[model samples]
Target: MSDTAIEHYWDTLVTPYELWAEPTSARLASAALDLIAPSTGSSVLDVAAGTGALALAAAERGLHVRAIDSSSRMVDRLTERLGSLAGCSAEVMDATKLLYDDDEFDAAFSVLGVMYFGPATMTALTEMVRVVRPGGVIGVVHWARPVGGGPMFLPLARAVERLDDPEVGTLEIPVTTAYLEGPEVEEALRGAGCTDVQSETAVVDSPTPAPETFLAELDPFFGMFPQYRAAVARHPDRFRALVAEEVRLVERGENGHPVAHANIAYGRVSH
Candidate 1:
């Protein structure tokens, strides 16, 4: 996806979840914190800090956190929500090209933010590694697997499959659980000079505002497929009916909750 397309998709589909799913977000963050081994007064950097979820949690835990995201709207929301937190601040910055000195932070982390990259995933990972001090932790969390784990990605996978694009073999985005389960994540960290790498599973609930609201938010990503856009635009009622059915299927297993399974990776850059 183009940068503009990706940005719009995030602004629409994810921004609201940040505001409404506080409890669920907190759970994943607590899991990440458990793996990171943060210390009191540690200087932390949260790259791709959407709505400041992990960053705020880190601050509340007594870590000094400086957070940044590629989306201005997300950064703005984070600032508004976290302004009063003495040790936390949010800024608009690209994860792939961080504007910071090397080894500037004691630890760095990203929560469910790695998959948005369009071929820039490595650059972002390297930048995260570069900013953290040697021996300091670099932690990451991404949605877990086979397209059924994350509700948000399910429709996306279905729509893409409908398009029948051969190149769409798998969702290569960092957010997918399959990406984290493989050896690639550890290898990437090792290539970035991180050692003692480890990753584990965590469940994160992503509650939608309403069915219509959820579908509307997802429209941007569906718009990427011409057939999907035409289907919804031409048969509005049918499109909504389809979404409703999918929602029912999701609610059954989740107890009406949209808790997504994700993987958390943690390791330290070598000193």
Candidate 2:
């Protein structure tokens, strides 16, 4: 699927869920931007630049940035944000099939957008590499495996698995992320014809609401998409209660303060 398609899907689920997930989302975005290290005056392409978080950071670093998101709503919002600044622009575009010509950007970056490609990850990476100047840098950040700390919805994974749906637990290539190591990221870069690939990990942590509060905020997400909406509709009260219970369990063990964390993998491609 195209980046815009994904963004369209996310626009429904994100806002309500974001109300609860904002802390972690901000932390992850900041961490990814730190790894990207955009230089002042650089021409940067921010793939899937939802809501302009990373793009805004790049502009703050004095970079000239053109950001694109598949979701029109996201791009529209980003445009407004960038219109408020002189050095940034936002557009609706796909990561897998970039509208820009080859060697169009000095650097390119994605935060958490790379991993959501389902089966089209390599195609998306190839496009990212193609748009950058030879020797220009490409940086990607994906959430590390194992649903790193917090009250993750292990039950959701289990539910998906039980359904035997191909989309669950696999990338577009059907590669299991459970084996995702730093080297695996390098391999993906190499597979995309990227030379001099290198990768490392960083920690992302954010403060979160109490279990009860968070789950209430999350209720809308369970209905954002058809599949999830069907599942939630099947037993809305039960699913809601389960999430609240898990949050309570997490909070009780830690005095109601839960800090969510994830391992972020950053991979760079040589120009």
Candidate 3:
């Protein structure tokens, strides 16, 4: 999808994205911050800020934060959420091309955001590094695998394949998972001139009240993918079949709520 399409999709889904994804996003943000551990009053940049999950977490810790996202609606939501916060702001900006000066922030981070850059992942990471001070830390959290597992979207991808839409092959979901595999993220940070790079994986489990609720939460994400949308438009019954398969795959947690597992890879930027 083009940048404009991505932005439009995000803007259209902001409400559902926040309702469904914020809790997990918040958990990942907390994990990334724990790894970076910038001092209070530190200047921080949140790339692809997305509803201000990381920005809000940093500001609560007394950090001065500048958050940016490509979707103006997402940025608006973030700004509203940051209302009255003393030292935080959100703006609409492309992650691949940061507008800040070199070494301007004490630290920078993204929570499942930069991975969507696909071929431009390195550019985004480099821009992130360029804006941080010499010894400042850079952190990122991305899925070890696609959320809800590969099969969740495989049917849709296959359908798109049958239609011969080359764009579907480049869908953000698959592209992100493919590019973020293993040491790829760490290597990218290192390649971006960050030193002392380190990474670890953490599993974030979000439990919904029931399987139905779980599927509802996942709906926004499924809708966000252009391939899924197109496939659903063309083959509603097939799409429903895939969704039913997804429902059957969901396992109940110890507490009876449906538990979704997200393997988050956390990387620390070098000095």
Scored by TM-score, the top model is 1
Cα lDDT tens digits, model 3, 59-145, are: 999999999999999999999999988878999998888888888998888887886677788889889988888878888877666
* Model 3 CA lDDT for position 184: 74
Query: Sort by TM-score, best first: what order?
Result: 1, 3, 2
What is the total number of backbone clashes in candidate 1? Answer: 4
C-alpha lDDT values of all predictions: 0.70, 0.63, 0.71
Model 1 TM-score on a 0 to 1 scale: 0.81
Q: Per-residue lDDT for 80-118 in model 2, tens only?
A: 867867768998777888999988888887766765665
Lowest lDDT block of 10, candidate 2? 167-176
How well does candidate 3 match the true structure in TM-score terms?
Answer: 0.79
Displacement of the residue 46 alpha carbon in candidate 1, Å: 0.6
Q: Return the lDDT, model 1, position 15.
A: 52
Q: What is the lDDT of residue 139 in candidate 2?
A: 72
Best by lDDT: 3
RMSD of 3: 4.8
In model 3, which residue pairs have backbone atoms overlapping below 3 Å?
Answer: 195-270
Q: Any residue pairs clashing in model 2, and if so which? A: 4-70, 118-172, 119-172, 135-271
Residue 32 in model 3: shift from native, Å?
1.3
